[model samples]
Target: MSGATGTGTTMREAFVATAGHLLDEDPRVAVVLAAISADVFADAARRHPDRVIDVGIREQLLVGVAGGMALTGMRPIAHTYAPFLVERPFEQVKLDLGHQGVGAVLVSVGASYDWAAGGRTHHAPGDVALLDTLPGWTVHVPGHPDEVVDLLRRAARTDDRVYLRLTNDGNARAHPVGAGFQVLRTGRRAVVVAVGPVLDRVLAATARLDVTVLYASTVRPFDAVGLRAAVLAADRADVVLVEPYLAGTSTHAVAEALADVPHRVRALGVRRDVELRGYGEPADHDAAHGLDVAGIAARIHAFTRA
Candidate 1:
């Protein structure tokens, strides 16, 4: 709530600006890029030539360099496209950062298939799922540029292994930065958990339905306590999870959270069953995956009715 007031800036731009500011303010902060946003950081690179690094097109080295920096007690902010950052160098991420037990901020843009024209190779719906394989990683899927500004500051301030997923999609407003979920609307029928940029769509999809809507930006530390509390308060155990990444990525987490209680969860997001082959807008992919407002409303109706 205390971030930007619905600024029109995109999350990617917000990150570049905030990162440059961090380089100016925090001496321990370093930025490692893989030629994704090198042009944007050119000025900063000129200013802090030592701290700002561009490792050409080597993503493996992008993370490797960040790990090396962390070894020297520096908090490195690594940036690149989603697939290149998380999928291409996953082993490096697992070993260089996770296995070595060093901390760095891994920021990514192009959520899922934001670059629909870039095709499947550019898509990374499984990034979060893959990262879940590692322990001690904090994942943040910010829904607004305001949230991005706040989350980046928090990530840069610490040397924790964090993945801040940036996307072209964003909510109309941003909730305060917190580990737990923030309830936007309360209802006794069911609870809808909207992750990151999908909050606005979820709200529109469920506008007529009587259900509780909870917004979550920090998802890695899945707020089980907050989820359980919302479920108990709502009285109905039917829960719906709408994320912007791979569908059911957080289904297991939801199941574990409500393990003791009898609950039913419907996970919705980018599908894993089939790869969308056509090159269209992100909205096309959303419709194909049943993530658009109409698709979401229909799915929610069917799930709740069943």
Candidate 2:
């Protein structure tokens, strides 16, 4: 329940450590890791060899094994980089998990450009978008280590299919888990929904504007009910969705949520039009995608003014 700020723990570290603890605490818990992040669970594998498994560099086998384990009544927590986790074995995820109706907690790190130096092979800006194609996947984008811990635990306990996304980028603070958006700042001009790590940037962007800022750790299952309430409270249809993935990933959901009412929405996130070959750091990619605080502020100002 406590935030991991200044605790010298990264979100990836928290995920691995917490998963190991789950393996020790719960007999039903099984962790399947690719060679990419196997080091994080080294101790867990040593302790629970039967429950903790490493499939080497095989991404398809990673997801297939997890799906098979889930079918046998084990709570499988699969971890790997974003591209390998979701992109490489997407069909396995779609058929093994989705087609079979089995559930597993798919936890991923190196979100989008976290490994910008590693090039496009390491980046996965479309991970969430791809998952969105499937049905009944609970997608969680945790902004802080605390949120990661909480969301991971929640996923482990459920029989529902879940995806916990972790990244190097994070917000300054963490909020409690709940349905819909948690209103951080109340305003009437517009409603800005910041998904996961983007909360900090969105807050900075709209600091001077009289707009409601809502933060969400759980994005899939879109929280249309919560969004409608915020928009109605603001008495305006100006909705700004700042996701951490591809732009407009959730635009359809937002539009559907406000279908009965008159509304104007602007979806912001990483751009998919072109590949950003100038990879250096996450900040560099963020700037290129116009997800930095300055860029977000400019977009918000223009949208609100119009």
Q: What local distance difference test score does each model get?
A: 0.92, 0.89
Candidate 2 has what TM-score? Answer: 0.97
Tally clashing residue pairs in candidate 1: 1
| Per-model TM-score on C-alpha atoms | 0.97, 0.97
The residue-by-residue lDDT of candidate 2 on 184-212, one tens digit each, is 99999999999999888898899999999
Task: Give the residue spans of candidate 1 off by over 4 A.
Answer: 1-7
Evaluate candidate 1 by giving its C-alpha RMSD to the native, one decimal: 2.1
Model 1, range 1-306, lDDT digits (tens) per residue? Answer: 111345567889899999999999999999999999999999999999999999999999999999999999999999999999999999999999988999999999888988899988899999999999999999999988988999999998887999999988887787798899999999888999999889888999999988999999999999999999999998689999999899999999999999999999999988889988898999899999999999999999888777
Using lDDT as the measure, the top candidate is 1
Clashes (N, CA, C under 3 Å) per candidate? 1, 0
